[model samples]
Target: VVGAVVSITGVSSTVTSFGTTVRSDLVLQNENHMFLDISLWSDIARNLNGQELAVLGRSGPVMLAVCSLRVTGATKGGYSLTSTPGTRCVLNPVSEMAHLVQS
Candidate 1:
């Protein structure tokens, strides 16, 4: 999905039986005003956090394209997207759809 990043939480660690998983939460809003909360994992999460801060400092919205996410019900209610190992995230992507989302 393509949207402007509304907010990004700081990176944190979760200790699971499998090991330690680093994660961050990013909230995005599309042109239609729909909101999506995406859980970015590992390196992607940390990188996106830095990008969000940098772009926001310049007073520009952070445009993001997140793909290959797994849709699941959110614990509080509706639905949310989770990044898998295969998920891809691009910041300020150059594309027709991304342009539309920006405008």
Candidate 2:
């Protein structure tokens, strides 16, 4: 897994799997131009305000922008979070698995 200290840009936007328009989370680059997109499978993210975090990635990480999260006061299993940049993101790891999990 690739580990890096990235600034938590914010929680992700709501995306419909339908149609041709693709959607994902947004994280700003450490230097210049554009955002990096990352896919979050669970309701495991939220918005951050210019907070930097140490993160270890999982699966096939994206190259466009960063992360996402389920919103506060949002209904269960519902995606209604607005794009909140500079939001902080938290990363967690499961304790059950062993070295069997790797990139």
Top-lDDT structure, candidate number: 1
Candidate 1, residues 31-79, lDDT tens digits: the string is 4344445565556654656455546634643444443344333345666
Tens digits of lDDT, candidate 2, 11-94: 455465554224434443322222334444223333322242324333323221233333322345744344344334323323
Show the colliding residue pairs in model 1.
Answer: none
Q: Pairing residues by index, what is the TM-score of model 2?
A: 0.27
lDDT of each: 0.46, 0.35
Model 2: worst 10 consecutive residues (lDDT sum): 57-66
Q: Which stretches of candidate 1 lie over 4 Å from their true place?
A: 6-21, 50-85, 89-103
* lDDT at 15, model 1: 28
Runs of candidate 2 exceeding 4 Å displacement: 10-12, 16-36, 46-98
Name the lDDT value of residue 55 in candidate 2.
40
| CA lDDT, candidate 2, residue 79 | 40
Relative to the unseen true structure, what is the C-alpha lDDT of residue 75 in candidate 1, on a scale of 0 to 100? 47
Listing every candidate in turn, what is its Cα RMSD in Å to the true structure after a full C-alpha superposition? Answer: 6.6, 14.9
